[model samples]
Target: MSTTTIDRYRFETGIYRPPSEGGSASLLLRYTRNCPWNHCTFCSMYKTEKFQLRPVADIKSDIDAMAAVVDDLKAISMDIGQNGTITRDAAVSLIGKVPALNYHEGFAMLFHWLLSGARNAFLQDANSLIMKTGDLVDALHYLRSTFPSINRVTTYARSRTLVQKSPEELTAIRKAGLDRLHLGLETGDNELLKKIKKGVTAKGHIKGGKKAMVAGFQVSEYWMPGLGGREMTGVHAAHTARVLNEINPDYIRSRPFRTIPGTPLHAQVNRGEVQMLRPHEQLLELKNMIGALDVTSRVCFDHAMNNWRHPRSGLLFTHDYEGYKFPEEKQKVLELIEAGLNAGNPVSGAG
Candidate 1:
């Protein structure tokens, strides 16, 4: 075991990733410090921090440190294979030498990443694509070069930011190794978008999403069912379906609205400015949106928040909440929603 002066990579606190990415073996890499537009009323993920992009040198150093750890683990594996077992002293000595790689959770995550074949990496701390195009492209290239085994690279992008990027810039980013872009289209109702301070209109969602798809990036658009609340439910469902129909993104992920304490939306609920839809009402809204969708993309309800259940059977329809392919499973999904509503579940009056 030998000590090295590699710069240690420490993840910033208050990080968030997509729920669907939970089982992914992707290495989490932070390119930016936080969300650039932290004004979304329903979100509090980046409220405590201001956004800043890490310098290319800083990011590359972190990547280098990660590579060094991977190499060391490979060497240890070889030694263990030949020697039958590694001694406690040998194990402690080997790990103690790398001062920069001393993060306990990081080492554990890396171990799982390696076991999962190290085939993917996810950029973190929200809106990695908002970095300067050239810097982001360079970072992507360097990351891929350092870890050739990574088959996919993904990041979250705001619709407002995506609309600002030129087609050429997005294509270059995709070519540089970013395989997918996840955009939160939350709702396509203009009034609701303003109410939530999402800072993007329905048209913006369609334009931004279509641009990414045209640039050859697999696009996943997230929609929230109860975002528009009780009065706006029908409008929310109809308009959101219209936007997704236009973009025809590779995936439409449903994230049913759940209020977080201290958020502006919660305050509105307290003041009676907005009425949050009940669980059953949210499912009915989902059914309306699904029936209205005309696209060929897969529709997913993969998040825990979306696991709507019937009170009697305590079962979630569509077989385990994995989601269903649109146009094909639309009828079956609608029937499931109808069954849940028919169960005579009470809609809670508390927002």
Candidate 2:
């Protein structure tokens, strides 16, 4: 067998991606570095690191390098007479040729994405929409052309950035192959929005979300359930439902709040400035929000943080990604929340 070349297998990867994308075998691509906004009280991601937009040329190089690995892997498969299929044996053989791959952080993720049919891709670190429109469009074009198998490409975007982008520029990027956007709305109450330093108003969230939909991008908006603590929970629920109703996004996901130790919100909890909700209190807030929700969006409690369970079946609300189709299932979801409220088992944040 020929010596397996491994240099072209190198490509950069970022630390974060949404759970749905991560679980569904999406190819991870780093188009930008770190969070541009970095100031959210609840978020700890990219706090130490500064944001840098990768040049278009460098991004193209990453795409090429990833393609090079694919080509080399297929070559290995063909050399081993496996008819060009990416097999475990071929991967093992390549690793034998390049021992350093055993320590590569992204190698397993890349290989698994390939094996799972490479249909979805997620752009990483924080927000990709902060990139200059032309650069982003060019990168998306190059990526889509390079990996013809990828049908959906998504990235985290901030509502402020989306509101800042011109409609035409957003349209062009959507046409350039960026299919979906995952936005962190956090909370929609004006006061909570200020408290968290999310940098976007409730009005801005509605505008940005509606704009993304208008520009032909599927938008998944995430809101934190316990974001407002006890004092603000009622307003948080009411206003969040209000903003989401205004946007009517394609998907609405509940990411219940848990403060990471280093984040500012964690400090607030330590200081007794913010009172975290009790287990069942979280569901009561959800009941308020879900009851008021009036949208065509898919409502999801997809994250493990929504831990209140029904006494009979265990694990209330089926935190599955697709979740319940709303309007039709709204009553059912309210009933589940009621069940959780009545049940004696305390809410557990464990998966």
User: Per-residue alpha-carbon lDDT of model 2 for 1-351, expressed as tens digits?
Assistant: 334445567788888998789853798899999989899998888999999999999889988988877887899999999999988988898888877778777788888889999899999989999999999999999999999999999999999999999999999999999999999998889999998999999999999999999999999999998889999999999999999999999999989889899899999999999999887888889899999999999999888787788888978888787899989999999999888989966575621
Q: Model 1: residues >4 Å from true position, as ranges? A: 2-14, 82-105, 310-314, 317-322, 346-351
Q: Return the TM-score for each candidate structure.
A: 0.90, 0.97
Q: Worst ten-residue run, lDDT, model 2?
A: 1-10
Per-residue error at 70 for model 2, in Å? 0.8
Tell me which residue pairs clash in candidate 1: none
Cα displacement (angstroms), candidate 2, residue 275, comes to 0.9
lDDT of 1: 0.79
Tens-digit lDDT string for candidate 1 (1-351)? 334443443433224778755453678888898889999999988788898989988888878877776666556656666342323433444566765445544655655676677888888878989899999999999999999989999889988888999999999999999998889999989998998999999999999999999999988899988888899999999999999999999888877788889999989888999888887788778889988999988888776665566666665554332467777888877887887777777342222
CA lDDT, every model vs. true structure: 0.79, 0.89
